[model samples]
Target: MTSAPPHQSILDKPFVLDLFAGPGGLDVAGHRLGIPSLGLEWDRSACLTRYAAGLDTLHADVSAIRRESFESLPPEINVLAGGPPCQTYSVAGTGTGREALEEVKKFIERLMAGDSDEEIDKELRKLSDPRTALVLEPLRYAIQATRSPNRGHRPYDVIVLEQVPAVEALWVRYAEVLQKVGLPDGTRYEVVVDVLATETYGVPQTRSRAVLIARREGLGTPSLPEPTHRAYEAKEWNRRNGDSAAPVAQPTLCDASVPGPSPAADDDLEHWTSMGDALAEPVGTQHRGRRTPFLVRSNYGSSGIPGRRGVRTDRQPATTVTGRISRFVVFEHLDDDIVYEGARFSMNEAGMLQSFPPDYPWSGTAKAQQVGNAVPPLFGAHLLSAALGLPAPAPEVMREPWIPATEEQRAKLRSHGCGTADDCTARCPRPEDQTPPRSTSRPRRNTASRQ
Candidate 1:
């Protein structure tokens, strides 16, 4: 395993303090980058996974933790990175996006006005929101850490945060506040926030997150890193940003594991990896010289939410793999000897799609929850690289490009007995298992697919 560059002591290296550190995503990436780090998390299942992964962690709620309680620093640099709990600010939450933004503003205004916890709590309770205020905890620590040592402070030299896209408003507001907290020498924080896609940084699946990066006044600067792989075609106006991501297509699910012609022989190959690549196994149907990719969570349930076709092929990058991925169905191709074809993704396969090591040594009863909640470690490395203004090397999990199986090899497999489509419906939680087609009258729940 690669370690951090030559630093005299752990103290000489800027340590990363990860808050709300679900499953050590940032911490694991920090280690890969040779950076020393520790995580602060409250979930027992996630904490167990962290210990299993050999990551340093403190199992406690951020709301109750104190930066002053940490060990004394050696007067070098340090980093504060985390994704505060954001369910209340997510589209999945009961609170409206506008309401969440207002709540954040109120929290800051109250903090600036020196309000008591009880007073703040009373107003938050009136808003019927409790978790919305947690975003402030990191700010509290950032301010505390960057204070002058004469004030007994352990001010962090950098701050990195992430949340759902809806919380971008909250993060922008935060930069406005964090810039004010300074050391005794009047060195203020430098901050930047951007919405970044995981795929743009080379993760197989596509997931967009709002990222915030900051540094001490003297640090060079805070800027989001340039994309490594290509992003899906940008909108008509987004083209002006000039990110200049690779002209090559974004990696597909197959890049992680697939049997195909060597790409070196042809320069115009698709870069996107496929689920089959990550799973490192064949689920395709056999017919003549062709083998069709396997389908997971494809439309084959008794019922489900509409517009969620869940019909991606093993040859394509899997859609955002979520925490509930365990419950999704796999529509096995109707090959010879398999009349009622179907299967579910093993926890390992799902985790791999999320860019985790194959044998992560997961230690949690809620395995799916742990996998879904944490950031993909590869993507986490990208985030850290952006904050540190360095390159995030591609993960070593990728195998060499392959040559497609010859016809003789393909003939050994079962034949595809049925046509291409799987007519069955998926099972949804609602009483009626049937998902009705979208009506022209009722508008879409969202304008764009949250790709």
Candidate 2:
């Protein structure tokens, strides 16, 4: 079967700068849509990933970035985009004590260019420049620094913020600040966007995410896009259900009788065929035995299967790609004999579900990290390009890297052997038992407890 054609973005192209741009997924989408894009990420691994995807990635923290960099950036940057770290506001954080919210509040205040002597003093005490603070601190500084004294102008035409669902309050704070900072009235952000998957656009995943779009006056309020694919009209779909909740028509994974979307063939989907294929390589001895299946399920409903499920939604767009690799939907073969069972979708497949092109090589960083960190390039490209009024980008065209026989990957494969991961012919050799035996001594009871 032939591969899908390159994605045609539904937006006018614009120059974009992706701040805190992990792995350049957003940039790629924009680039494909005829927008010139640049990525800035703090992590070296992430920078490498962006470079491989053909983006001009900078290895610098947002806080450390100087105003000159923005001033000197390629003239095409009409948009500034990023997703700040949401650890303090994250529900999973232990730092949620008073100090956490205080820090996050300070961050929001700084983003609005509000000055506080206490925060400045705290930075001075730490022997650090307040200009180089994390989260919103640098973003605020960048905005202020890039402004021209003579022209009295701002640095960007627009800014986009993406974050976790658990941080709704934080987004509200962001919206508050955006309004105060001269964004035209009614330019507020929505914490939750109703987005459907490939089903609407003709792919197949029930993916949902929150999206926030803010722009300058000329750009106007960004309106949501319309859907192209419908569930009942597609012959591949076996079941159909209209969503009363969906503002637009929603798509299905397949049909009710069939479980999920279709799978790509060995040649088309080879990179996602096995567990190890999801990761570039292991991270240290700590991750040596941590292998994730290419298919995973939640109880028995949603799944993480390879190349089967598409994006799902009918209203807004998808959320950023995440390393929650095991939470995506799965696709099982419908044949009498189930060849790959209990499988979860690989990291690369997860990227695709988010609309990343197949030829978008995710490199440098570990596969899971790269996939998790990447913005859905398609979303970024389509959104920002439309905002810029440029043409769409062409699809990726490149050959796979030549794997030498003596390379480490090949050597390891030879040492162990390769076929189906299901073939357990070469078991992981048990290391010399290092664990100590349980202590035999009984615990002595406290005799003086009568006091």
Candidate 3:
């Protein structure tokens, strides 16, 4: 692990308070950068996974943590980081947050107007999904840290936040508000907000997230991280033949006919990582002998096309992993027949695809959801490095594998006397009998033959 250089800021040490910290993704990234982090999360399943990974955590709702309590927190805490709950803002979900965007802005205005917490909480309760209000909780903490006399009115040196791409507008609003916040010392936040594609940061999946980074004036202006990998171009596979109604078949790793996205004209960045590149050497003992050149078929339809399933070859980066990841099927071509490869991605494999350590201890139920929702630790490290004005972690450092939890860490969980079935020591259990669903559409030739 690499330690951050001594900062020139007022704080002697840097500690992090991560809100809505799901499964310690950003915390793990901070740890790699030699920064200690404490996370607040509400889900028991996520908390179990966090404990198993040996992350410091308070398994409580963000809303319940009063602003006054911020004063009592560790004084060295100078960094605020979080990825608030995004279900309502996700395009795949109900869109409650998207619909309530204007209303949420009004709440921000109220907060700016110095409305009492009780007044804001009362109004937030009436939203369709109360979770939508959680998005503003970071701003609340930021306000408390910078303006509340109870906290000595010391502004956090850095604030980093992330959410689904749909929340970019809200993050922009945050940037605007944060830049105007003046502290007692004549310092204000310098803010940057943008949508980041995870694959461009070397994560082996194509996931887009809205990110906001703020740093107090004089520390440095925060900026988005530069890409370390070529962006995945879906257009490479969308080339059409004249008069052909159907699109061309996806290319495989061995298919030399189709070239990848052209590299940037000015900078050198590695080609996008393929699923095979990440999973070529299986992580755990159970999957050590599995063969490669497999294909993954999504259980859900693509582009809202009925019966049109999405498929990706091992040579390509995976589509975004989601809570319903268990519904994806992994299979290989055996002569003319399709053979299932372990039914689907194991929990560890899914984590690996998301750039987690191979032996990262994921515990408890909804394990797939936990992995899906996590910030890819690799991406997190780059983002944090950018926000903190530190050197980017070397590619080899990011790729170095290790067991996330030590035997002592496991013992610590046992000492807590947690009797739940999803015990911390045990590997995250797979979904019950996750057999691949039979395809309803007419079977086409296997992806291997498409080349």
TM-score of each: 0.69, 0.55, 0.82
- Candidate 2 versus truth, CA RMSD in Å, comes to 14.7
Q: Return the top candidate by TM-score.
A: 3
C-alpha lDDT values of all predictions: 0.59, 0.43, 0.73
Q: Of the candidates numbered 2 and 3, which has the greater lDDT value?
A: 3
Question: Per-residue lDDT for 34-125 in model 2, tens only?
Answer: 45666666665565455445566555545445433445455545566776654443443323322344456665665455455367535533
* Segments of candidate 2 deviating more than 4 angstroms: 1-13, 66-76, 86-107, 110-113, 116-142, 145-153, 180-207, 227-295, 298-321, 324-348, 389-451
- Quote the lDDT for 390 in model 3: 71
Candidate 1 Cα lDDT to native: 0.59
Q: Which ten residues in a row have the lowest lDDT in candidate 2?
A: 395-404
Give one digit per residue, the lDDT tens place, for model 3 in 1-451.
Answer: 2223433333446688989898878988888888898887767788878887888776555665544355556666789999988888998876778999999988877786678888888888778677788899987887777665655777788898999999999888877766774433445778889999999988888899999988887765667888989887766544521111122243232331233556778869989888888877755543452355666766433667665566666766788988877777776655444444545788878888888877777888899999989988889988888888677767556655645566677556534423332343232222231222333445756899667
* Model 1 TM-score, all chains together: 0.69
> How many residue pairs clash (N, CA or C atoms closer than 3 angstroms) in each of the candidate models, in the order given?
25, 47, 0
Model 1 segments more than 4 A misplaced: 1-12, 67-77, 96-98, 109-127, 147-154, 180-187, 233-270, 281-292, 298-308, 334-341, 397-451
